[model samples]
Target chain A: MTKPLLTVEGLVKRYGEHTVLNGLDLTVREGEVVVIVGPSGCGKSTLLRCINALEPIQSGAVRLEVAPISRESRDLPALRQKVGMVFQSYELFPHLTVLDNVTLAPRKAQKRPRAEAEREALALLERVGLADRARDYPRQLSGGQKQRVAIVRALVMHPQVLLFDEVTAALDPEMVREVLDVLLDLARQGRTMLIVTIEMNFARAVADRVIFLDGGTIVEEAPPEEFFDHPKTPRAQKFLNTFTFDAVKRPHPSSLADPTT
Target chain B: MSIAVLRDYLPLFARSALLTVRLGALGILLAVLVGVLCSAAQYFRLPVLQQLSAVYIELSRNTPLLVQLFFLYYGLPKLGIRTDPAVCGVAGLAFLGGSYMAEAFRSGLEAVDRVQLESALSLGLTNAQAMGSVILPQALSISMPALVANVIFLLKETSVFSAVSLMDLMFTAKDLIGLHYNTVESLTLLVVFYLLILLPISILGSLVERRLRYAGSGT
Candidate 1:
């Protein structure tokens, strides 16, 4: 097995008295793709935010390789560079062109030269099929296109781990496929990604391991096939049942027994 | 109105108008500099500096510019510390305008969505870097209208500079009326000169505002 690229041990996050993540622990090895799914307010997004050090943790530690992720750590900036995150809103810098947005971090934070960063950014933009829109502002693009640009933005950082927080949740129904396709492409390339998503089909297609979380704790985790087809825990079974249309569409036996039909 | 009196004072008005423009520009520039610094202090929540900035904003904003100028020019010499009239004029204007500009800029800074900072941080940018690059530009764009309004306001406030005996446009008009007793011509020239000074700025301010809106919205 490849070495762990990211590790979380006893991760605790709280907003005031209400604990959002209750001592959750997770690990991602090199080039592993982990898909986390849970009901609303289950702390999946908070977990990702804690991992990225966007939110301060209450107790547990998150480490990128060997260095700890925290506000006080001297190497935090360097460590954060290795963990790229894409938000659901597609938070592109509105004042910049697509090309400029892609190049900003490399140039400003990484201190890369303008010419070199632009060269790499242009290539990445081309890879994402956004070469034609390089000079366009973010507002001019469709939701899918903006999400794709966001993915490219994260990718250009050459991060070892990528966190996607419902990257498709805000998209139009038709636009969701385009963003999911991009994620599938990234997974195919063996990029290390921790994605929180609701698209079950895409999750089944792309996830190496599926994790079911509830009430701020992991209920079950297994390979996608086993987890989805045969969820061992009753909570996981109950959660999975919510996603299936059969629960609502099929009539209950009591109703079927009635002769009203 | 006598044409001869109007003709005689035209040159004086022109020179005084130039002085008003120069002083107004200086004061407005100082106001912007102070405003940016104070707003940054408030936004970053620096230890003592933040408290100092808060006090400064309240102190400046609550008092009138006339009172501020009086305190600076007439009140300060009692302590045996003398300030150049020009310096006093600029400082007084900045002291007044800075708080207004700071309020405008602080609102702009506050309006920036929290996600921008998060995205910038996740990309490994430091807090200062995130603020300078990601936050400030958007905030400035949002603050453009308020900032322009503040600028026009500061320029008009320069009318108070004559109270410090600077021979600004108002002083020139008052001096001419005192000497020649041609109140109508002097006051008319005062109105015309102020219009000339303020109209261009208001128009230019709106143009810049529109440009920023287009750039921000891409519409």
Candidate 2:
């Protein structure tokens, strides 16, 4: 558990003149779940992207296990294979059936046997409750089902670490639970994951450690219970208070209890 | 009187239509191949190839196919490059058709959401693999209607092949009108033969577009 499976040191990401992630540093040990909470445009998503090497950084380095991941890295494909990422849009390959989407990378990139890849993909799809949708295209699936298929697609890669960039942000209310439940199951299984999300209750329920980020930096990091009940920083308290205020002030008192949950 | 002349020229019209189909198919095949290559060069931003593709597309599109065939068959002989009339016909049609096909593919490639590429990269696909397996299929589907339109345009453009002396439908029509003075009958036969070759393709294009629309509905 103490072994750092993934590490980001002083990562600096900028688009043109605007800097998004400013000298950020973080580490994720093997079998740990870290949930990141932040306001929109605070660089939570940027940090995850930099770690996955999907976005190039101006400075600093990201490492999975021992090897550094960078644009110049000779083995970027192999390096990226070890880091699975799920996007908020559930970017399943729209042209492919769910099974084909899940099996594509394994068979094509890794050069695995098609039958073997399909078998593993079917098992993962079954786990995500999408086994029946194996023949269906992305357009045929609902939001929750599509996200689950996306998760299966990532899991089929057998990555050393996973990054979830607001995975449930775009899902409808009822669909949110199905996706979060999948994440909670993965957490219970001790999968190493770094998640960026605004769902405070899900963050509290699943995080081993909650990281509060603001203005391109970490403002606070603590255990879930401690951070949720008794945030140390004034900024953290104010952010949490907004969620509470929104919940209390809303006119609809119907099934809106703990709205984020 | 016209019906009797049309019956008399049926064999000549059939032969001419066959030649036209063969030439049009060859030209469209070459055009599609060139189009995919040029668009790929633009999409991937290949060094000299991208610029050359841009120049070729502009030059080919701006000039007429008849002018291109004339240059290939007539003008090139002065420069000691006498190409066969059939080759000139196919090449001229390809030159014109390639630019339109490339533009169609480029638009389709651009319309694909950026997330499609990003997600493929996140899943460990190499740039080539992502483009080939993920991006190209979606782009091709999106480009279907434009490609069908280009195919029809190229086939119709095959009418100019007769100027280079290839004995196509237009040449057969002109020869019959000159010899027998049956202009209406020859032109009617020409129209019917062209429809024979083009109507099936138009119908097939619509069917494919509907299927693709169904598959790509929510996307």
Candidate 3:
């Protein structure tokens, strides 16, 4: 069997008295799209942040396949270049144009030349369908457009794994689809992604695997068809019942037991 | 009312004006350099240096400028440190200007968001590089209007130096009034002299404040 592209073992995080990630273990194969679905405040965002070292983990090992030779862990900055993240807030540098924001990290941190980084940024922006908004500042763009620019900014670094932390949480209901479409395109391109989202239809359409998290632990993990159709945990069933489930036609796994007889 | 008297005293007044301008320029320059250094030290939280700068600012700001000038010019001589009256004037102005400048800079530093510094660090910039390239530029822009005000105040405060026996503009006016016993004419010339220097500074300060406000808004 091929080794997984990224592996996390016993990942744990805490904030004073409260533990957020409770020894979560996950592995992603190369080019796989994994979606993490959870209720609000269930450590899904914290898990994604920990993967990129944006939030410090109390204890655990995150190993990437790219650095297979060294068992010794590297620092956060080195790991960050390999795992790019898209935030819910779309934290674009306010002073820079969209093109400059996309190119800043590649040019400054990665030491790529200005011309080369600009070309890559333009191409990525084109991919995200925001080519015309390149010269505009973040404040000038709509919420959807800013999120697309942020995705392109992260993509410019050419990271091996991408982490999406509620990328559509801040968008207007009408604008959410545009941002989701760009992410779907990236997923189709065979990029490894770990997305944390509440968009059930989008997750069901694009994700090969879905992990439902609650109370600081992974409650269920399986292919979307099996997990959504036959949710084994009582918590997962209760959680799914809260959402308007008619958007996706996928049947619940335990639906047969709902007979009126 | 004699033409000979007007011509002779006019030359003296002109000479004293030159000396006044020279002293004011040099004093403001020294103040700017010292103030910037002291402000930076305090802002960066350098331990002993911050305490020293705070003490200096408090002492200079609280005391009267006239007394400070007397202390530097007269008190220093008692301690066997004899310097020229012009040097004493410059030192006193610089000391006073530095105190006000420090507060201006402290507010400027405080106005910058801490996130900008964190973003710089995330981009692999060292602490000093981030401070020099990112923080200081914004801080300096924020401080410019207040700094200009301090410069104008320092220029006007140079009159205090006349008490220490420096033949600056005020001293020249005093000498002419004493000799000719025309206090009204001499004091009127002195007022005009100050307005000439101070009006331009006030105008420049407003212009710079407007520019900085525009730049800040555009960003």
- Candidate 3: stretches off by over 4 Å: A1-18, A22-29, A51-79, A213-215, A226-229, A245-261, B1-219
List chain B TM-scores, each candidate. 0.93, 0.95, 0.90
| True lDDT of residue A143, candidate 1 | 89
- Cα lDDT tens digits for candidate 3, A108-198: 6778999999998888888878889888877888899988887887888888888888999999999999999999898889999999999
DockQ order of candidates, best first?
1, 2, 3
| A1-261 per-residue lDDT for model 1 (tens digits) | 999989999988889999999999899988999999999999999999999788988899998888889767887777888899999999998988998888889998899999998898889888878899999999999988998999888888899999999999999999999889889889999999999999888889999899998999888999999999999999989888998887468767898898988
Question: What TM-scores do the predictions have?
Answer: 0.93, 0.92, 0.72
Taking the tens digit of each residue's C-alpha lDDT, what string does model 1 give over B108-217? 99988888899999998888888888888888889999998998888889888888899899999988889878899999999999999999999998988777763464
Model 1 TM-score (2 dp): 0.93
**How does chain B of model 2 score on TM-score?**
0.95
Indicate which candidate wins on TM-score: 1
Tens digits of per-residue lDDT for model 2 on A200-221? Answer: 9999999999999998889999
What CA RMSD would you report for each candidate? Answer: 2.6, 4.5, 6.5
Measured by DockQ, the strongest candidate is: 1
Question: lDDT tens digits, residues B1-219, model 3?
Answer: 455655566667777777888899898888888788888888789989999999999999999889999999889999999988888898988888888988888888887776556444444344565576557766777888888888888888888778989998899898888887877667766777778778988998888777664223122
Q: Tell me the DockQ of each model, to 2 decimals.
A: 0.63, 0.59, 0.18
